[model samples]
Target: MKIIVVNDSVYPLTMGGSHRCVFEQCRELSALGHDVVCVTANEAAVARVQEPGGFYLSTYRRSENSLAKALGFITEPARIIGAILREKGGEPVACLSVQMFPSLLGLIWNVPKLPPFYYVYHGSYAREMWTQLWPRFKRSLKVSDLLGALYGAMMIPVERWVLGHGRFPVVVLSNYTRRQLIDDLGVKDDRIVVVPGGCDTQHFSHSAEGRARIRARFGVDDDTSMIISVRRLEERMGLDCLIEAYADLRQRSEKKVKLVIVGKGSQRDYLERFAYERGLSSNELAFAGFVPDAELPDFYSAADLFVMPSLAVEGFGLPVIEAMSCGVPVLATSGGGHSDLVAAIAPQCVVPQATARALADALVDIFSGRTKLPDRSACESYARQFSWGRYCSGNLAVIDRVLAQKSPPAQTRA
Candidate 1:
């Protein structure tokens, strides 16, 4: 089957959870002998498209001018419509992978020619924005905060309308996201398909030699305990909470432990300051700062445990699975999508969010050998179930079902 995957960004260009997930899906689909063309933004287009892959890639550059940026806010749907028409030529395309802004664009522009598009609702942006905004308002009252809240409120109605009216088959990355779409956005239960995001299990799995090499390279002593947090340094990630938790753990534990923070973001300075304020030395907390993909496995294997303290804004915590694949025990917050993934593998380690004491306690338990770590064999076994190959196959099955139904497009009364 011929498929066109449409999104604002793709892998190599955007190295985040969503970008990686979409790229994996495309790769898997291509492996299954499907002709896949991925359409992404042109900023990182050349780099991403040049990679050796089975799927074809095409990109459109959005203008960077101030006027264009302002216009894009209103014309995003029209732009996607235009791109689709140009890409389709005169032949009918079978399906389009539309999400977020592009999903709404597909609804508005494709109208009569709309294919059986699959909407991957990674998560609700408005909800995330609101989550951030509420905390700001509580901390300090500001005109900017009020304006941001107003903007979020304005987008909520439009987002809900697009989800409700599109009526396309929806593929969600987590059960949490699926529930939000059905309960908050009023999307039909039948239309929603829960295809949890996956990791490259075989690629990420641990080897004894690889683990030893990684530890040696880091100058880590055999007895040293390593705690790794692989995530963007963003407020929603709750890195501050992790640092506080680690500080609390250090106060209680006599063992030698180090925190390795991977990935970089806007909150680096703030997180650094927070660490210093907690009296943590540079050796105790190392901000590795954006390790490349090829070196990711080394870091994962180098760690004794992985912790994701993200309180919210997480549709699916991919690192937890990656760590588990590396035979590393994972302790993640019982909030958002992490709850679902961690519960499925290591329910005992799922702790309450923002509870630094609980996080510290969990870490101490692992370090002290009080709580049994997740069975390495079981971790490997559970990780195998969420391979990219399985993820794409499930998605293709949904697309085929959506296309075969042949339901007439629901009319919109504007």
Candidate 2:
């Protein structure tokens, strides 16, 4: 099969989980004897023009931040169109779009020879701004709150229109997201399917030597109980709540503990300030911003506990799964799709939403022997269920079905 995968934020350009999924799925599909082409809005994708392993590449100038990228994709749709046109001389192929912005590739140009397009909805950004930002921002009135509100207002209509306009099936990460698209966004019930995000189990597997080395490099001793939360520095990530819980944990636990926060984003300074205000210091709390994807398994292997404290807008908690794959136990809030995954793997670890107190108690129980985690082997076994190979195969099956039934929809964007 010949295929084209569309996503502005793909691997090597952005470390976002959805993009990582795009990278792995495309790579695996290419390995399966399919002629795959990745059309991206990522400026850095120029480096991959010749050949990125088995798949081909195309690039465009997609700038920084959500707002700018949103505008760039709409204003400059030529790169995506040209890539599709170049492939038009061959056998008819299907394009798998990873999100809303990239799904507009054909619609923006009104391409005449477009093939079947399959849409993948990671989550609703509009819902994040509308539901998550308003309550938090109205109190402080940060510029981000206002910007998010505006972005949400613009995205909700475009999101719905695009979902309705296209004659393609919507691929979602979980049952939770499928329910959200159908119930909240008015997408047809049969239009979406749940194909969960997958991890590279081999890369994320346990390593005792790696754990020792990573901990030593990070200035953590073997005796120190290291708790790590690898999340994008954003408002909806619930880092503030996690920090508060860490403070609370310090007061409750008798053991020596340290907290490590990873990733980079707009809320870094604000989140750091919140950490300082909570009485945490450079000694107990460390912010390791933007660790390389190759080094993540080491961090997870070194951690005593891996946490996902997302307040909202988490279509799937990929980090939690990664950490689990490394044989580290996970503690996550019962919000979004984290709960469903956690419940499937380990239900005892899910905490109630928006409460540091509950999380603090859970932390104490885990470290204090009040709550014992399953053995590392058991944990790794559960994590292996969601592998990248399985993820690609599921998406490929869907693409095949669509390719057989429907002709590509004509451009309907206004």
Candidate 3:
């Protein structure tokens, strides 16, 4: 099978569950004897010379803001158009596209050849912007968040069209996203396939020496409790809520705990200020910025618990699975993809309400010994099922099915 995926970026080159998920799918497809070509706009990949397995052809320079992103989208079609022209066709290539820039543009650009394009739908960014930004806009009256929500509101129709068009098969990363397509946009149920995203279970598996080293690097001692989160420091991530929860947890408990927040974003200065306002001491909280890909495992190994306090619906929490794979218990907000990861292992820890009081109570239960965490071995076993190998295999199976339906078996001579 020849697979061509068009998306904004890939992992290491970029961060985010969607970016990493698509890259893993492409990487796995290439390893499974398919010629995979990833056409992206990630600045890091654009600067690089080459990659292993298949290859990368960039469409735009790296983007940091919405305005730059819109301009980049305007230029994206050119590279993809050239790539399509270069392909020597035999069997129809499966062109996989996820929701970032409008899928309409990709389909419109490829209309001449009209390749067998498949839409691998992640969560709707428009829905994300509206859900996560509107409240902030309402309260702060910030023009920036209003503009973000307005952009999302404007794109809702595009997203709706992408999901509902009968011609394309929508591959969603989680059942939550599948529901969004159906319940929110009226997409037919059969058109959507729920293929859960995966984690590097083996890489994040427990390591004692790694844990000790990571603790030393962070200046956290063995006796101190460590809570770690690797989520992007964005508004929807609920980092502010986590800070409030952490402060409440600190005041209630006699034991001192260390909170290490990793990953970088515009929210850093705001989050730091908020933390201090919430009475979090510098020693109690540390922002490690972005940990490199090579050292992420050690950070997970160092965690006593992993927490995902997302205020909005996550497509799938890859870090939740990664931390669980490392034998660390996870506490996440209920009512989103976070439940998909926690249900089998730490179902009880899903905070019913995503708020400081609720989160603090859950933390108190675990850290204060009121609620015992599930066995580390059980957490490891549950996480093992969500490996990248399994995810890739699932992706291939669906694409193979799609191709088979397109080209039926020829009749034999009587």
- Writing each residue's lDDT as its tens digit, candidate 1 over 114-203 gives 666778887776665566665665555765655565566666787788887776788887888778788889999998988888888777
Using TM-score, give the best candidate's number: 3
> What does candidate 2's lDDT look like per residue over 1-414, in tens digits?
777777766786778777888888878988899888777776554634635757877777766454565556554454465556665477655554546543464444556666666778778756765665565567667766656567767778877777766667889888878887887778887788788889989999988988999788778897898999998887788888899999998988789999999999878898899989989998899999999978889889999889888887778888878988999888888867776788787788888655888888888889898877866887799889998888888898788778777756677988
Error at 230, model 3, angstroms: 0.8
* Model 3 per-residue lDDT tens digits across residues 1-414: 667676666675679888888788877777777766667776543522346645544445656565456445545654564556565865445655544545346556544665555677767766776766676677668776677677778777876775676566778877877887788878899877788889887678888898999888778887898999998987889888888999999989987689999999868998999998887777899999998877888898899999999888588888988888888989998767876678667678889899989999999888889887877798888888887788888777777767777776999999
Q: Which rank order by lDDT, best down to worst?
A: 2, 3, 1
| C-alpha lDDT of residue 69 in model 1 | 31
Clashing pairs in 3: none
* Local distance difference test, each candidate: 0.76, 0.78, 0.76
Model 1 lDDT on a 0 to 1 scale:
0.76
- Lowest-lDDT window of 10 residues in candidate 3? 44-53
**Model 3, runs deviating above 4 Å:** 44-49, 63-65, 74-79, 86-94, 97-101, 131-148, 408-414
